[model samples]
Target chain A: MSRVPLTRKGFDAMRVSVIHTADDIVREHIVNKSVVMFDILRASSTISTALANGCQEVIPVVEVDEALAIASRLPEDTCILGGERSAVKLPGFHLGNSPLEYTPEVVAHKTVILTTTNGTKAIRRAAGEDGVVLIGSLLNYSAVAHKLFAAEQDILLACAGTRGKFSLEDTFAAGLVVAELVQLWYSRHNAAPEESCSPQADPVPIYAEEVPVLPENGLLLEDAAVAALRLAEAYRHKPLRALYDALHGQKLAQMGLSIDLNFCAQLNLYDVVPVYREGKITCL
Target chain B: MSRVPLTRKGFDAMRVSVIHTADDIVREHIVNKSVVMFDILRASSTISTALANGCQEVIPVVEVDEALAIASRLPEDTCILGGERSAVKLPGFHLGNSPLEYTPEVVAHKTVILTTTNGTKAIRRAAGEDGVVLIGSLLNYSAVAHKLFAAEQDILLACAGTRGKFSLEDTFAAGLVVAELVQLWYSRHNAAPEESCSPQADPVPIYAEEVPVLPENGLLLEDAAVAALRLAEAYRHKPLRALYDALHGQKLAQMGLSIDLNFCAQLNLYDVVPVYREGKITCL
Candidate 1:
């Protein structure tokens, strides 16, 4: 059975464990087994867009050879090689992992066998965990949270910061997620005195204690929750799910990768929650 | 002779070090022989303020006994004991370390004996070394740079972050010092193009190769410069000079013992450089 319908406030009550390095992700049991990937940089955002545009599947590999080997196995028309070393594009590839490059015209209905410096390394390392594995970015945050709330497992929103170093954009986005999840959990778990002991205590208090609390009813409230909800509803479940739109989403949109962002931001997009199965990511 | 006049561009270039824990700092270089103290929270900021005010002298002690012991040595009407445990002012402390708390009216013309958890410990550790130590913070960044430039000796702007853990604020302040010193060094060194061995042998290229170039003049300009400069400056300085500012100045200011930002900010106001002399801090 599903654990419980975790309200928005319920999520806020929990503290996020900050996974600093690629090694930290491996060492931390909780992170290895239960976290979702959130890379706000051009990589994850672009990958989400590529998937949503009807790509066959995103097979994340670590090394260049690994990506090529996987691509060699797939039908030539069905798969394409892509990624970057630094800010520059790879020497000889069908694409670079820029969301701006993965537009509806370019990547719509193409399978991207990809690897990245950091994000893919994280994905490869977290391949076979026991819990849900979801993609998170600014584009699909609301949809991801709503789905996460419905599932109600302990969540670890892993921010794929640059090369194991802290990046402001990633942390800021994670803070937004923690803030939203708490609010949603609170909405569902806030119980009257009669319902207090019924396994539905308010999650707001828990978040207040563990996480850094922003101003009450402040920008954190509107950005993490309200704006996210609006974006998800507008996409109508097309962006967050499906390999095609997942590769292109809203973060890309504002970054001039709008086509990708539009596709990556879909709400309630996929019924099957992806999980790490047998050293590989698989959907339920 | 003093090294050289510092350029305006010097202080603008900044970098910071993220000392994650007490263990990390200790492991890097912490022994009884090592004269280094820690400043985790607002002690750096407070001390900057105290020196800015008209405080006659500031005394730093490690233990509570040391603080009281030092106070006993001072004239009763001239001295005050101050500091804090957490954010709260200590039981007998005449003041709490907060930038907002220190004002000229209360602190003017007073002598203060101060102690704190992290900053004091770090200061006490670095109490005796060959180098002169001066407090560094946002409040006195320009002044520290000017003093260090004139002294021509190695400058170590140690940050007392929280309980040995890295605090963003302290790290940021450290970066400011690094930026200033590096720029000053660059401007002075770069001005001597006529002294080159050959017309084609510009030393600028060699210098650039030796020192890491900062990021482009963009949004991350401030952050990028701060961390880079801190590391470079620390490495460039002679390693022997050990000095502690905790006994007075910033530490004193934090305890509400006394000083002002203006006083701390005054560049090279003191011709007498305070170096680590004997087992305690003294002006050379």
Candidate 2:
């Protein structure tokens, strides 16, 4: 298991690149041989919830047409077409992109064919990575950290920005992931072990350079970092994770899509991790 | 002056349609429209400092050769050639893009013929606005606010992004300007200022509307108003305005560039506010 420390401030610093499109990410080589999607917004967040609740699989498509095509093969009542366009729910879609939309009653035993303008594109760009492809959001932030801690490669929190741009909410989500990775790395090596078991297993020092964590807190320490941290810390209590709701999320919620905040804000709800593999996103 | 309540978070909500080149800004009818040039790495910050520090005037040219030619026409030892090519100081130029290069000793009473890859192009695009043409940065944040508050028309904060894509630093700077404007609006008019203020009076309120603010803060804020508020609230303390020792300023401090933090931070120092007029920037 390897540990990476990504401070909130550090993450803020590296977020200097506002990735507009998946093409932009690829152009910049943002994948860096490792990639993970950070869509704090409802798409990725909802996918995490759906998978955790009971969905068999998530098919990420770039366009609404593709999502519909995928849905055509599944039983209409057994599968849901979910995603957004211009921040609004697609026409005739069974579900909109909101974590709250994936209630156990709504998503249980279903296959979710999802497509979004940004989230799916980001996932697609990160698909060729040589390492684990875990879904990250505030809901399962810690779970992703545990997975990364146990993995053996570099990490990239590819933010599924709203329409190919940078979203503070997603960056904030990435920062949270970075923070946990750092803490986990430190705990595994630096902190005094409870048992102090074997002499053969030496407690290694947790140097930031070793784990190669993205500095989530980088911007927080900068001129802009202080402000961003204040925003995140201010919402330390609420389902402010709700603040990250995609444009689609709000529209659907207004239409009585889903009322439960628990789905959106539940921390560490699922222990199972979803990994991106061979063009499909699935849980192992 | 009108007090608008702007924050970083609020500014993120609006859609930021970025015009990639100065030509695009012009061809797309964005030139002279409300725009902000976001040069987060250095040039914009440096220029802000240079203007504030009592330099006669900044001749913003695009081509490096043009900048050099303009400098040659100025009085010998009275003009300095400064700018960057690829984030590095141009070969044979007096200075680089680092803020530390511009200083009082170098730039005092001298004109700087400056050209950079992105910032200069952004300036050209913002060549015709009915509102004030003010430079923004961590260096002269308050100065920019004072200028905008006193202006008669709407305000645009353009980010001179790296190349044609979004740069995190520039968008963050735009977030600061938007946040400040929104904050002032909130303080003066309360919640319904949108009902009272003209688009020209406080254009910041209309950030929710699709009207592109020109050089977009696409990556910085998803919701313009909310993102702006969040950014301002994040940096509510620890005045970074005093740290305006910028690229040209640092060089002047040594010999060529002439500027200081006090000058850059001098709120509303330029009684004569510049604005875009007739395809070029001129005094209002």
Candidate 3:
């Protein structure tokens, strides 16, 4: 495929793709673009909330033992251990997989050594990627979207599905992000050209003609991204209600983790954009 | 997990799960429930259409060589070998992965030995299940839903995701099926209790109070199932538009297979329910 020059006028040609599970990550192909990873049930939301609460940084390890090993190497007073297995806190761990637990009082000024069943694995998969990797969820929705828009690169919304299978909450979070990005692109592209005198202005209104036309050889949405956008649109009117009624939400409720569901469902609750770089996630 | 007793009075407790990819199939667990396999961007649609057009039976083989070997063993004129690799037909195959090619004149009265990139692999994964296996798509949506409702057992909507990754089209198709089932269940469960004087009647109307109550410990929808239903609801207004704009659909169109997209996008075009039993998919 010939590389199309990125011109300021054609935001519609920017591609947005979604990877539904951590297991589906294609390292070679994915390394070429920026990625936003979502584990909305708790991991990503917790990380966002932790950073928003003034946590120094979060070290994500794939195994509980690895988190313990890393925590042992750090000063005990400056670091805190956090993670969960099967949605329950691991024995001897300081925290479980709940965003409510990562409050300002608990995580402030501390480096959180985190490991979870799915989120860390997804982060690890993108560890070798040359592009930027960011942790995202409903709590930090606009922050991540703004960062992604500024990056000016193709976006991949990677969903950290539960235990190698598709998770509704995570996929929904991805859809939410993708939908926001599409909307942002459209709003910018559809604005009256003379209003802002911006370089990214197209004098020709793309949809004004009798038969509206797509750009010639435009950047098309990958099917998964399209589906995610549709999903985001579907649940736009009471996102919290949808989250409460999700299958995982019910399971979490059954396990007495209703607080986590409530915490994860709060949209745009945090203004921090959690950047995962150099094996650690810290607020941008 | 304790097995919930099936009762006519409570439909909310019925289990409707979705397997997003073939890789997520747990043979031991999935074998216990009836499965509806969907490969909306084209396999399932083609199979359903073929059966609806009076094809004798559709045999799905996972391997291209297996399909060829099976075809060689059958009498020359009665059997036809069909499949595709990268959206194109094999050198000597009778058909490619286009639903339009499987019309009444081409596939009627003949047995189709079929293989494809993803659909057959999904079918083979569920072949060992001691339960009903059916081919489904938008073309025969109502038929498959009626059959599933009549079965009165747990339903697993298995999406034939592209090459072990979630394909937007397949997931959307699964969502469509689950949404229809949920709607069917609600309509039946919400009818006036006193009007019917039947054994299925509930003495107290479940939704009569200010706050509607779901049956106690009734049927539960898995998270993926709930997501699918929501997705189905999202695209209910313009499903064909969704299909034409699907990632895979765009790719198919790029490959000069717009005819298949048009054919697959048609809803309720066929009345036949294609049943896959003992290795053959035959019309009911």
* Model 1 lDDT per residue over A133-183, tens place: 566666555566666656544555565655555443444344445545655
- Ten residues in a row with the worst lDDT in model 1 chain A? A198-207
Per-residue lDDT, model 3, residue A81, is 93
Question: In candidate 1, what are the lDDT values of residues B128-206, reduced to their tens digit?
Answer: 3332245555545655665655544323445564443334334444544555655565566564322211111111221
B108-127 in candidate 3: lDDT tens per residue?
89999999988887887755
| Winner by lDDT between candidate 2 and candidate 1 | 2
lDDT for each residue of candidate 2 in B65-174, tens digit (9 for 90 to 100): 88877777777788877887755679888877555566777776777777887777677665543322455666656556555544422344555544554333454455
TM-score of 2: 0.66
Q: Highest DockQ, which number?
A: 3
Q: Which pairs in model 3 have colliding backbones?
A: B12-B219, B13-B218, B13-B219, B13-B220, B14-B219, B175-B228
Interface RMSD score of each model:
20.9, 15.6, 9.3
Model 1: how far is B219 from its true place, Å? 8.8
Binned by DockQ into CAPRI classes (incorrect, acceptable, medium, high), candidate 1 is incorrect
Model 3: lDDT of residue B42: 82
